[model samples]
Target: MAYTTDFEKLKKQLNFKPDPTRPVSKQASKNTKMLFEYLKSIYGKKHLAGQQYLQSEEVEDLVYYHLTGKLPAVRGYDFMGVSSCKKTDDQVDRAIKWATQCGGIVTMCWHWYAPNDMDDYSKGSSFYYKTTSYDHKTCFDLCKGVTEGTAEYEFIIREIDMVSAELKRMAQLDIPVLWRPLHEANGNWFWWGNHDEQHREAYKKLWYMIFDRMENYHKLTNLIWVWNGQDKCMEVSPDTFDICGDDIYSVKEYDHSSQKQRFEYMTELAHGKMITLSECGYIPDPDEMKKDNAMWLWWLPWWREFVYKREGYKPVFDKDGYTVINKKYMTEDFMKRVMAHPDVIMREDLPWYDKDKHKLPDALSANLERIKSK
Candidate 1:
């Protein structure tokens, strides 16, 4: 009774047609299948727009704007809810609740801090780039059991297990998450990325291991796996991810030429899998993306601090200047226009997914009982 078989049965029962024209990863879970089908059903018809809010306060502004105009088609959440590196569960919950209210799809990214204290705490490893020695070779070996039964292996497994538990909670809530982990791995920023040629296979191997542990071991099926699209790291196996994307950033406004090239590369590399802008410093104008034929499933600009700033200008906190200049990047006026575009798809445009069909009733009841006992 393989878990994949169960997913196949569910897909068949639900009459989901996996688009033969698209490249669907073999490892796509049941939830992934449904998501892919939905995306395919509407490809080219509309592009989803999204934003990442750094604080709960920001959420209110986005919510109010969406309520009056167009809501984001997808909401992005970080796994800060249960990470040992940081605590922001309350903030995470607030984001999720808003998404649920607006019928927006949810995607998650994890800034999985270096395993153990192997990270150079004093220097930095915030999201990308390791300022200090965070040995990728040693860490990958321990994580993959190449150094089986060692302290490092035990420590990492314990940590990942905790992550698994948090995922299980999301499943119980019937949250279909687009799970993107170890993103931007081809870059040298994250400890998980920039492995030497010998350890080049390490990042890929780590991804598969996480998939196996979460699906086969923890039985977490409510996820759509996304692979980071970097030229060198695009060599992932056919079955690793349901979708692929690259983070697009430009020092000056949306560099149209640069955006077109990167978007084209990711699409071709995807082999028909849906391509998206996972993270962006400046949200490409919907009109521009369409003009370039770089149709992304969704484009989520980073938090206000990143999205609102001009290319090299120092960030201004002044209320008036902030409101005026930030429009160059992505202004409320621009967003309103984008959301109103016929080619753009916002949260309200989505077709309903059967909540019960995707739910883990057993897990949900157990969680409730635990809360009651507490």
Candidate 2:
């Protein structure tokens, strides 16, 4: 129904003149806004939380502490994946219970495995690549094996399916998990990378198949899908990706004038679908990226520097330790520079996850605002 009338019109307009400088028309805006509101109503209020909200002030505290060699803050970035340093599962559960004792939502991170369903290995380090010992390979292998395998996969699916049941069991919780998946698959290193015909073909096929297979298929409408990928991958202009992108990674000091080119290229190609950073890393001298013509002149996961010691391919370690990466010295000043930018921690631009049993609306809004901003 929406497509037949409102969506169709917008699609036609974009087809006619697809330019970022040109704003989406009034009718299109109204239509899209209505949809956004309705979606916000459904997911934001009923599923996500009662209202648009924010938490974890002083975003820099998280990064600054990490920079000083201290752990991330307890408010948002603490848990390695699920639990905080101080709390056990039961203790954390008790804390969530306490938050909702007054009737408020508690947030969690929703995880989705990326670059899967491929016959070969290439998208950001797959099992085929892992046998050779890439750092991401082991994690990817576990995630894919656990998520795709019948036993563990069934458990993961059942957990999501059981969310409603959990909600029914408790009156205090209403928070929605900001689920993100297949992040940064656009790079040619993942199993589902779109760089090659075979990989691209398989990626689309997997998306279709994933939709077909999930038990809680209804929950997808509730889930917010964020696609993360390297900016350079869009150069091929190969396949049509349905999800909005989040910038996955970049180095600050390199000659990266091409970064924004990559961003604009991907954004234009997306036709205003919605794009964010997903995960922000640190980049010193972001101006270099601007000068280099790069898009999204930022960083993602300082650890990814270590993580990039990926399977099979050794882009950074091509030879002796002499093989260089971004900047040999990621100085404190560089860290401070990135820590100060609003763009780094914006959740809408860089939502770390959607499922952990809670969410922070303010973080989400900050990111969404950045994307909507001119």
What TM-score goes with each of the models? 0.74, 0.42
Deviation of model 2 at 192, angstroms? 3.4
The C-alpha stretches of model 1 lying farther than 4 A from their native spots are 1-33, 59-68, 115-129, 132-146, 254-258, 308-325, 353-374
Each model's lDDT comes to 0.60, 0.34
Model 1, C-alpha of 45: deviation from truth (Å): 2.7
Residue-by-residue lDDT tens digits, candidate 1, 87-133: 54654564456445445688888776543344433332244333445
Instruction: Output the number of the lDDT-best candidate.
Output: 1
Which tens-of-lDDT digit does each residue in 245-360 have in candidate 2? Answer: 45434555432233455556656545544333334343324455435433331233333242223334332432322222334334555554544544233222223233354343
Model 2: per-residue Cα lDDT at residue 102 = 21
Q: What is the C-alpha RMSD of each candidate to the true structure, in Å?
A: 9.0, 13.8
